[model samples]
Target chain A: MTNKRVYNFSAGPSQLPLEVLETARDQMLNYEGSGMSVMEMSHRSSTYQKIFDDTKATLKRLMNIPDNYKILFLHGGATQQFGAVALNLMDKGRADYVVTGNFSKKAAQEAAKFGDVHIAYDGKDNNYTHIPTQDELDIRDDIDYVHICQNNTIYGTEWNYVPDTKGAPLVADMSSDILSRPVDVSRYGVIYAGAQKNMGIAGLGVVIIREDLIKPHKENIQVLAEYDTMADKDSMYNTPPAYAIYVLGLVLKWVEKQGGLEEMEKRNIKKAALLQDYLDQSDFYIYETEKGSRSRMNVAFKTPNKDLDAKFVKESIEAGMTNLKGHRAVGGIRASIYNAMPYEGVEYLLQFMKKFEEENR
Target chain B: MTNKRVYNFSAGPSQLPLEVLETARDQMLNYEGSGMSVMEMSHRSSTYQKIFDDTKATLKRLMNIPDNYKILFLHGGATQQFGAVALNLMDKGRADYVVTGNFSKKAAQEAAKFGDVHIAYDGKDNNYTHIPTQDELDIRDDIDYVHICQNNTIYGTEWNYVPDTKGAPLVADMSSDILSRPVDVSRYGVIYAGAQKNMGIAGLGVVIIREDLIKPHKENIQVLAEYDTMADKDSMYNTPPAYAIYVLGLVLKWVEKQGGLEEMEKRNIKKAALLQDYLDQSDFYIYETEKGSRSRMNVAFKTPNKDLDAKFVKESIEAGMTNLKGHRAVGGIRASIYNAMPYEGVEYLLQFMKKFEEENR
Candidate 1:
């Protein structure tokens, strides 16, 4: 099969590393000479057990996860986690949320169904273009857990630093920017990422949670929604998404080969800077994101008019660039330079932008 | 990659059709000149939407699903349905369950947490060797739904006929033998199948639910777990398992090419008869299951001793027959020939069993 010639820039369910795709393709039919597609292998089989274990271990090594944290591979994306977190953690009283993006807002709204949810900070006033500063947050001391989205995929913004929640555990939905940079995994109570973006696929979500938070799960929570039961069973309390997990293991191996999180951060920084610099140089297109809070993963921008923006996306697609159409809520072009997007793809975009700017100006 | 010279008979995730694997391999990187892997495409993208629609439509056609039943491609496997079924339907009062295999027992156990659950019948006394007879059942008239496993993969037993549930809705977990035979789908209020068996992969579960059953979602149900909400959104409420769904589409197409479920049933019957005939003819192997209730999907047999059973499994593995080990609870050998297992694979297994019997005798 021929490699994808065009670059994909959709926020999540974005691109994957070429090597990861190649390895996955090579092993599609017979993983490790098992004579079965990874999809066909039993989750309890020794072959899949190794794949599952290695994937989790590699994630731990890459993220420097502490011993107290249990990493779980779960189904139903981060959207499902909204209810799970609320169901599991919001027993004492209320939970605090820092709404930064469309997803975070949805999470906060969903949690409201279970308990009293307080919005500690919200970027809605700024049209979600900026992440809230530390001083702007209004976290409550009595809250169960503080929730936040680490990276705002739609608005082109990300948290530069983790919030200090004092005694309360901090839970972050890092759906887009996970493994793109290194972090102190021990500091956060829970960190979750849908595999579509920095990881591999869309079906599986990985959750790294401190053991203490899961202990409360014994108190009348639904069995299917309980983290403790799922974690204890090694995510095999039920039949898991075996193929997704296999592809994730391959992606993790590829991440390790690419020098882990440090190397990814460096490459991601360079790619973001290259594209942002070109956008800054041209006045024809304006970036919707705040200068200080721009996301390295998703870069949202807009032209002077909607028609122009549509033309830009169309012409860019013709020029071997796809999925640059911005989100509907934020009408513009978003160049999501995820870990898999090669720098050359961004360079091509820059060239196209320069030519378009020269002709329009 | 060299194919492992072994025939896998694990219930599920079971063997995949060789042709499906080949087609998937050929289109892994670029799907239909889209310049993107099916994994990379957006769920809402026209290319992927078509695949999604075609898969659902094909499955409906193959199963004879009525327009009133909405087919949803969901994550979290059938285990999630254990809770979802109760949350969606048990609002009226209680549910009737027939405990047969490990999965059904677990499902009944989970459903008990939500509302009043009545075990209409159980096969545990018979070591799950026989399906619950109509005379043995004690279904409640006030029950919201009657739940059963159509085929118990672990014990190699299948329901020879569907239960007459009077007026109550019939819900069956057809995870093990979903597409292997044609059924009157309109008769059941809900039928769910985890994709690993007759469908495609492990990440997605197909739920064919009657529209009326979904309308009465109780208050305070998690949005993700709410059947009505999911069905309303057409299963794209969140980023789905894109790659898994794509593979399911391929498998559905493969099923169509192989002459649909009617043809599949014919092949399954022939294959199952071959293995069962060999077992019935030999004194060295004892078919523990009742003669009339043997599953076409899984065929379980035992030897005189545990050590002999162990030897049989070991020798079978060496002879390129794999995963023939039965469930740990029932110490024996089980050959699971799902929809993907060709008639020739079962023929080889029967020949091997005959030779082993001769040598052991």
Candidate 2:
């Protein structure tokens, strides 16, 4: 059979670079003369250790992460971190959470089980269509840490500026937007992202944390979830997700070769503009997210009606695109043009959208 | 270059069948004409959902899992389940733990944090060389469950008979020997394994639990760690390890085509016999595990001295073999020939051992 690669626009576990996939396929049988697939190598072997170390080093360099911060490749994704962040750091028994969208709301509820969780800001008042401005946040200095979801994938909203947490350490879940743009790693106590998005594959969670917050000896938490132990062991306390991390390493190298985060930010801005500019000009489509808080990763929009939106999604798949249907919570169309989604993919999507709009009208 | 596959025997995350690797490579670019890598597909997409369903169904059939059992794909490996098993099943405030080897000892310690843990039996007395018989276990009928390591990867031992836990339910960590032989799924309440061993790849944990044991609404535990939530959601409560599960499905299919577990057991017995028989007749090597308790997956042995053991490991690499080094806790050699290791691999290993024994002595 012919290798027919198409344009995939799923939100998380979304598209990856075709080049990266090809490289992975090439090395599937024998990885760098190791005489075995990366899937079969022992985590403790020197051959595999190099892959693990290089993956972390590339991420640290790409993020401009300081020596004080550790890059941890963990399992259970960012959803697991919702509890881990609180279990290890909520020593003061209270923390402020900004409920920007679906994931942030889940984080606040999960943290509530571990400590006294205070909602510093709730975007639900506006149907989670926008991120709250810094002045609108009610964060307290007494709290252990202030939590935020940097990018809301489902709601198609992104935090434009970091909130001042009144001296409290900041924790951000960048599951959808990490690696798409540059960020000040020093500003946050912890930043975690699941690998299924712009990073690479699923089953791995990348955590960048300030060294001081990692308490390996933290009581009541499992050893695997403890940031200190995972960091101390260099994230190999036991058998790690070897193949996922290897694929993640390959993706990071691909990003680095594309000229670091600055180039990524420039490209991302252009990709988002391609869709947003079209949405702005079109009268038939309605982009609900406020302009300032719109995400460069996920573009959630709707046609004139539900029936037409369904038809658009159905037709788009036949036209060589998939995963354009929006989240169920808010029915519409969402084109998650992540880093791997080439500019040409967006151009093709725009052409389809325009043709669908003209014909349906 | 040539795809030179070598003999790898490093316990967990060991070698996989070359056929599975070839199939994975063929489909790495576009999985079965879905036009996207499995890593890129959304968990909610019907195309990806079918992969997930087929994988779970294949595992259920291979294990002959009863209808009352729910199979879950989770993160954090079996180590994560060390805490998860206790958090979900320690409802009676305690459980009986049988400490057989490294993993079970760690599991017992982790379970101590959540509930009352009683050491039903400790094999450490024999330096973890053997599994205790039924009458030797001081298990309690009132406990929530009786925990055991079905196969000890580190110490090269296997439970020859399932210990009768009176009326208490049984929980086993089958990380090292899960699919190497037929198992009576109905006899155990819960059996969990890390995929890096007998299953496939790393970063994915397979939990086969009796439906009654799954407590999704179990208070005080994190949502992701709750077995009921994972089972109820059919292991898609969140973004799972997609690529790992896909590879696992391929491995399961390969095993099914190899005439299922009965055939696997037959081959495993022959392979283990080849090594054990050689060790039985050899005077230069020492196999410490009791005869009936020997693991077919991992064969741990030592030379007459530590120096020769090191030399044997160093020379084996040059002889087209790798990962023969033993666990650091016990400094010797451990040849982990899991289900994926062919009979010829074992034959080659025996050939090397004979040559090494003649030269070293």
Q: Candidate 1: how close is chain B to the reference, as a TM-score?
A: 0.97
How badly does each model clash, as a count of residue pairs? Answer: 0, 1
Q: For candidate 2, give the lDDT of residue A286.
A: 92
For model 2, the stretches where C-alpha displacement exceeds 4 angstroms are A1-3, B1-3
Write the residue-wise lDDT of candidate 1 on A3-95 in tens digits.
545688878787788787788878777787777777778888888899899998998898899998999999877887888888888768689
**DockQ, each predicted model:** 0.60, 0.70
Query: Which 10 successive residues of model 1 chain A have the least lDDT summed?
Result: A215-224
lDDT of 2 at B17: 91
Instruction: Please give, for residues B167-235, the per-residue lDDT of candidate 1 as tens digits.
Output: 899999999889889999888999998888888888787899998898756667677778888888899
lDDT of 2 at B62: 95
- Model 2, B281: alpha-carbon shift in Å? 0.9
Candidate of highest TM-score: 2
The DockQ-based CAPRI class assigned to model 2 is: medium
- Residue B253 of model 2, lDDT score: 99
Write one digit per residue (lDDT tens) for candidate 2, span B1-361: 2357789998879899999999999888888888988889898988888888999999999999999998999987899999999999987888999998999999999999898999989988799998888888898768999999999988999997877888788999999999999999999999999999888988899999998887645666777788888877888888988888988999999999999999999999999999999999998999898988899999999999999988999999888899999999998999999999999999999999999999988
TM-score, per-candidate, Cα-based: 0.98, 0.99
